[model samples]
Target: MLLMFLSRFRVLISGLSIALFIVLYGFFSMRYVPLSIPWLRLVDFSFWILSLGSCLAGFLDLYLFWRKSPLISTLLITIIGLSITFFARLLSVFYSLLMTSFSIQILGGSLIDKESFVITTGAVAGSFLILGSTSIHTIYKEPIIFLKSSTLYDLMNTLRNTPIVYGSVRELSNDYYIIH
Candidate 1:
């Protein structure tokens, strides 16, 4: 159980770190130069798509997580929604930054020169797909893990010691013996 939590913790932190780095890179670069370069029009579209996807995915994730762990209903309803909103916005920025970088690489053009619109769009879109994929995968796993790892699983197991969580221990033991 501890190992499971630790692994989950690491993945969450790593994903968040990468997301933060991408967002920072985007904003910092924009500060020095305007975000809209003529070549990078695609980047804008990609960011928009990414933004939309994040919002949708976040809502879906929250709903599923709530269904799995109804105990955290209020927290999930309010805080989870906020968290999803923040992630969606952050993801769009990160996608833009990554796409911008990729576009520069593909063009084999001098990084010093600003790119045109199309290159930006492709790059931004690509970035969104990459980052969004990770988020989608994590969201898919969260509910399953939370539902299975709840105190209910532990309490269910403890019932084995009492012969109450399920039914009669003599019958259970006999069944187990017969199966073995």
Candidate 2:
């Protein structure tokens, strides 16, 4: 049962793991990176949003995985994850650009300015690293193979055979209408 669940949500699990790693790395590495810009708050906020988006995407993937049709769900989840990653990358790039511009303006393109550019570029690169790792892991993981197991196959068949209906009935003019 545990294996089945893991296989079904492997993509989400792997993606979350990568995101966690990035978050942890950023947390620990922040001490070493100098904060000269006044707008560091904005960068921090963007990073928080990136982390939140990754987590939400993971949950969305899990929700879709349990639905009746998983192939389409998987596709949708993949697209969502990719989109989230892309947005995060863009945010990071924007943050980096701001940092670069600030550094150049204040430092007159000195060694400090170069350092800021490197730091910002590295931050954005880290996001891409997470995306690449998650993509590779998702591509190689065999979630569909789990569906072939006898137990899972039977369970899915049973679920498909069952019909779920929810409705409120209203009577008007000697006729009843069901709204679901």
lDDT of 2 by residue, 1-180 (tens): 555554455446445655664665466457445444433433444444444444444444434344433443233334455455555445455555676674442222222333433443433343344344335435754224323223323345654664536664443223323355
Stretches of candidate 2 exceeding 4 Å from the true structure: 1-23, 26-72, 102-180
lDDT of 2: 0.44
Cα lDDT over the full model 1: 0.40
Clash totals for all candidate models: 13, 0
Q: Distance (Å) between predicted and true CA of 132, model 1?
A: 8.6
Q: Which ten residues in a row have the lowest lDDT in candidate 2?
A: 105-114
Per-prediction TM-score to the true structure, in the order listed: 0.28, 0.28
lDDT per residue as tens, model 1, 11-53: 3433444465457546645654544453233334334444344
Identify the runs in model 1 with alpha carbons over 4 angstroms from their true place: 1-36, 70-142, 146-180
